[model samples]
Target chain A: MQQGPDKRFLLLTASLLAALLLGIIVATGMGYMAIGAGDILKIIASRLGGGEALLTDLEPTIPYVVLEVRLPRILTAALVGAGLAMSGVVYQGILLNPLADPYTLGISSGAAFGASLALFANMTLFGHFSTPLFAFVGAILTLLVVMRLSTFNGQISAQTLILSGVIVGAILSAGISFLKYLADEQVAIIIFWLMGSFAASTWQGTGLVAAALLVGLLVSLFFSRDLNIMSLGRRSSDALGVETARVRVLLLLTASLVTAVCVAVTGIIGFIGLIVPHLMRYLVGPDNRRLLPVSTLAGALLLLLADTLTRAVLPVEVPIGVLTALIGGPFFCLIFRQKQKARSYE
Target chain B: MSEQELFAIDQLSFAYGLRPVLDNISLTITPGRFYGIVGPNGCGKTTFLDLLSGGRRPAGGTIRFLGRPLPAYPKRQLARQLALVPQEFDTGFGFTVEEIVLMGRHPHIDRFASPGPEDWRQVDLALERIGIGDLRHRLTGTLSGGQKQRAVVARALAQNTPVLLLDEATASLDIQYTLQIFNLARLLVEDEGRTVVAVVHDLNLAAAYCDQLFFLRDGEIHRSGAVAATMTAETIAEVFGVTCQVGWNDFSQARQLSYRYRSHGGITAAPSPAGLGGSDGA
Candidate 1:
């Protein structure tokens, strides 16, 4: 009897993962350079095996473009998507709210504030990494402050945490606006960065997001069952032996960490975190054990496709954040409408 | 603390900030009996249940379960010993009836492992026991009020604990479902020797099913005894400030009570919980 859901989950996860792998292979070959799929696979195989001799047959520029120029950005986009979606699953589960996402706790705003300050000051402390470093710090600090404000004698109420995030986010947003006003000529750079993109992605950025996503996924899946029981409200979960407070804190912190790392690397990619889990939930049911993994795969594929469209398919490169919202908003509406109609019919 | 006592509450006291809810209450719950906690609104019946279920620590008391301090037991271990069915469940998520019942096996299942065949068997048995077998795959949100309550009770049944605590679980159900729930609890006590502690607002229903009754008033136990011993007109008036006549009902073979308001010439402005029994005030 239980095999029905489990089999469906396994089949869904396998197909999505296969699709993601196929996407990566195809996406790495696309762009103005137009590397062939076979050459792309050879390049990846040689690089992974640490055998440069296998790649000498191709033009030198082709290897450089495939490995140094394109591969990092593609992997980074996928990883960031996966991280954001996984964190979204945790956020929605812990808050027991459909609207919650990775950025719901003001983490994105905090990162934006830090990036704005660095841009406004024309900082070059860490060369190209200066703004991202600052943004990461700002996100972590905001998370700490929100947690502190929400904690009353070591208990964090979901409602209080959200309210605290809104309060802090509003203040930080005002600060960003003031900085933008003062920038004069520099405001365009700030606005573009806030719009979010993966153009500046490097191997190091890819590695960072991948590492965070792996750890976050493991932690999330481990406590996914406990997360399901938490939706029963605090008292029943406590009676069911979920240790609600401890599990909530652990998952919240872990999710925030994953989200901070992703935002630091990608600037401010939106929609994937908020929409992927919801979409997956519709297909997979609300069992977090199934929903979390499937959403991660779907997110990785979705953002990969989006980034590919901007980088190669489109006449001009559009910000990944803007594209996601533009596309995701409508698709989400369609699903919502369809679901509502189905319920009414029932 | 005797080994036979399931819960021994000593000087239990609780307060919602400055305002007291339960004060200096002492009670003991033995195994293999149906206990109905009856009280008017704001009389701390729910709080007493909360204390027993370890949802809240008493402000000034010691609650011992199985001869050990309640807090000393680990959360999962405590769940294996006792289960609680709340008033109602509300969620925006779509969890099937089977999934909800399987959650009762949480304490038994390991964190890294999924529910095994045995756990699924328990879920099936619980569903059958609660007469919800046909609705196993249905989403809980789509269930009727009575069906949802039965599903929740089935969850507790799946927990397979020695004791079950219900906090006004049938308050929203119709009379038929209410009687069905009470009958289920009575079966657990009579056939399985499981302890059932329920917070009930209906006096006659409590009298029919519960072996022992505890009436609470002003955060204290106003009376506690068998229905035949403690149920009377004077006790009802003192605890609830309403007049009632206690009589036996042959159909149910249990003591029944009919409530009436005290004659005050005209309706008073003060709010009362009990409704008018007849057009002519007693």
Candidate 2:
């Protein structure tokens, strides 16, 4: 019977969603100003029902700080978290590489280069919109270059794709460094942005990422079964009626666009995409249908936790990107080692 | 031999740029026959398999499926008719045996719909047929080579297509599993009247299992006929570039090919595919 994966998936979905809610409340409560969990819920509830505050016992400064300052940042972090993780699942599945993520195809470096160029030129042409727009364009262009390099005779090969990504990624990194060397006073700002942060998040940015993720996730789920067959390799998937070429291109573009938008907004958040899917695969197996949603929620919880720690728990703030790699690297290795040991028994 | 032609092909050619792997090949495939294509390494057997399965298209000439042109059929519709078990399967992912087998029902399952009870039943039946029912819960990545090969075969079997193509599907299997796959093919042909085309490396297995044999050499069909008549020692030597003995295994009531290193002086290299039985080079 299909009791095992089905039961585990349903249970896992419910629990992970519950965990996300708990994480949001707890993370929002754990900040420097110290808002209670109950208060966080009331503030969120008041906004949800579109009415005045249900519970107004908190100070005026706390509500303003929570809503005007922290909410946009927190929500954007959560949305970007989910979006990146979902794109990561897609990239890893389609490319047939567990090591793949939103950044594996050099999209992050491309975005970084674009953002750096914007900073170097001091182009406040679109006010807050200029850097993110350039970053989006850069990531998409990188995806196109990698895709073109990898494709041959109407088929895409994962081996060539990864190789092309590395090559292009190196070139983009050198470009970013050159731009950095040229930036006299703005180099520090460029470096800071490259480290990733949610300090300047806005509601519109959150909406943009949320919309991208919503559409991207639905498309990903629609083709999840084909993705499952694809892991068998190109020939088998084609033999199974997958229309491998079409699905591969469609999923590739969808995932890359999602990653582009997420990277554009968040300024190159690392490890969320890389780490979330692996952690979710262990908890729930690697079926993309289950993996996509679970990993997304886990990503939101994880980034929120990371952002909260950097913003509130620590005396001095650390870059969210650095924090993730530092924490995620060792824990991922430990989990991977244990996973390998468990797998050897099978 | 008035069997219905399921595939009617003429002047089929395929190439990677200018280097042609399959050139000006023509053949008729009849229903309910187990056909084998075999020759030396890089004989374009895999390439031919890919073309017939529609994983690749013919660079020149035409292939008609049933009565219509091969390209006329939609990809999903074509898949509903023909299924292939590839030579190699990547097991790096963590899909379970059951989940993998269930993927075969994709042609029948709608895009938005998950597999239903009936689909699972078919998957279970295929697993049972391939004798992998007990390993249904196990991860495909964790399976041994032979077991993984069987799982791959099971996925094809689960597709339940009218035409099945196996590209060295049993290459990694044990002797027993090899025989088992052949038997299953024979059963599908005899009992269900399904057409099967397998690219076999083993000469003897081709002899015993396949009713029809196509011996390819240098991208052309060297010989194509009933297996017993087609797989002669001279034909084998000419096509494969080696000497071999053909004898009957009375218990199995089928011919067997045995290789010997001693060079044969009787058969010179066949200049063209037409020179299989005669000395005429053109």
Candidate 3:
């Protein structure tokens, strides 16, 4: 009898993994100079370990565009999506609020402010890596501040955490706006970064985001059962032996690190983190044990498709961030309405 | 501390900053009996239960469970020995009833291990015992109030602990379901040798179900003993500021108490001969 749901969950996860793989391959094949699916797989295989001899026959520019440009951008987009969505799952579970996401704790605003300052001042202390480093620092500091502000006598209340996030986030947003006003010649650079794009994605950025996603996924899955019990609220989860305070802090720090890495790499790509987990919850239910992995794959697929649409299908390039919100905002509204209707019936 | 005592609370004092909730309260809970903590609205009944479950630390004193200080035991080990059924819960995400019950196995299962066959058997037995086996697949949020409370009780049962603490766990249920929970608590104590402590609002229900009753007034145990001796009309009037008639009920074979508000002073009449007419239906 219990086999029914587990089987369905297994099938869903398998299908999602397949879909993500297909999405990445198909998306890599799309661009101004379109490559065939066969060549795309060959390039991926050859890059993995098949040796340079396999790619020797391909046109130099084809390999260059696919490997040097499109692949890095595509992989970064997918990994950022995965990290955001996974962190979103942890945040929502920890806070016990559906409206929560990776950015609910103001990590995005912190990253944006850091990047904005770097751009405005032309700080090249870290050479090409300066802006992202600043963003990472900013996000970590913001998380620390929020954690400190919310924690009272070693316990972090969910309501206080969110309140602190909003307060800090609002101040940071204002700071970013002030920086934008001060950045006369560099205003375009600041604006573009704030708008968010994957056109500048590189192998190093992809590697960094990938490493973060891997760590985040492992930690989240380890605590998924405890996260489930935590939905019963603090007192009850404590009674159930969850060690709620320790688990809550560890998960919160892990999730914030993942969000910080994603933001530092891809700028603020909202909505994917906020909506992908919710969408997958509707399909898979809210057991984070199943929900986290499935949502990770689905988030990767959704963002890859969105980036492909903006990069290949659209005549003029629109910021991928704008495209996702445009697509996700309405989809979320639909899900919310359906949920309300279902509850009314109950 | 006696070997037979499940909990030996020694001068346990808790406060909310300066305002004391439970002050210098001491009690010993023994195995194989049902204990009820009854009090007025703000009489620290829930706080006392919280202390026993190790949810809160006593400000001034100590609580020893099974001859060891409560804090000395690792959380998971302690959870394996005891379980708490809370009064109100929000299953924030729409987890299924089975999933909720399976959480009872948390302390028993290793951190990395999933629930095995034995865990499933326990969950199934708990669901069956709570009479909600058919509702296992349904989402907890979709269940009615009484059904949700029953699922929570089943979760506690699945924990398979030696001690069960209930903090007004039946306040929302209708009389029928309320009686069902109390009866289940009694069965667990009498047959399984589990120690059960409940914070109940209904005096007659506590009297009917619990082997030992602790009456709390102003954060102190005003009276504590066997139900027949501790549940006098004078105790009820002093603790609750109301007038009650205590009598024997032949139908249920339990001491029953019926109360009327002192504010309604004009309507003085002989105590209703139908003593505890409401609980008789159960």
Best by DockQ: 2
TM-score of each: 0.94, 0.93, 0.94
Could you arrange the candidates by lDDT from highest to lowest?
Answer: 3, 1, 2
- In the predicted model 1, the residue pairs found to clash are none
Give the TM-score, chain B only, in order for the candidates.
Answer: 0.90, 0.90, 0.92
lDDT of 1 by residue, A51-83 (tens): 888787899899999988899999999999999
**Candidate 3: true interface contacts recovered:** 0.65
Provide the clashing-pair count of each candidate structure: 0, 0, 0
User: Model 3, which residues run further than 4 Å from truth?
Assistant: B266-282
Provide per-model DockQ scores.
0.47, 0.56, 0.51
> What are the per-residue Cα lDDT tens digits for candidate 1 across B110-144?
99886888888899888987778999989887877
Runs in model 1 lying further than 4 Å from the true structure: A152-154, A344-346, B261-282
RMSD to the hidden true structure, all candidates: 4.1, 3.9, 4.9
**Better lDDT candidate (2, 3):** 3
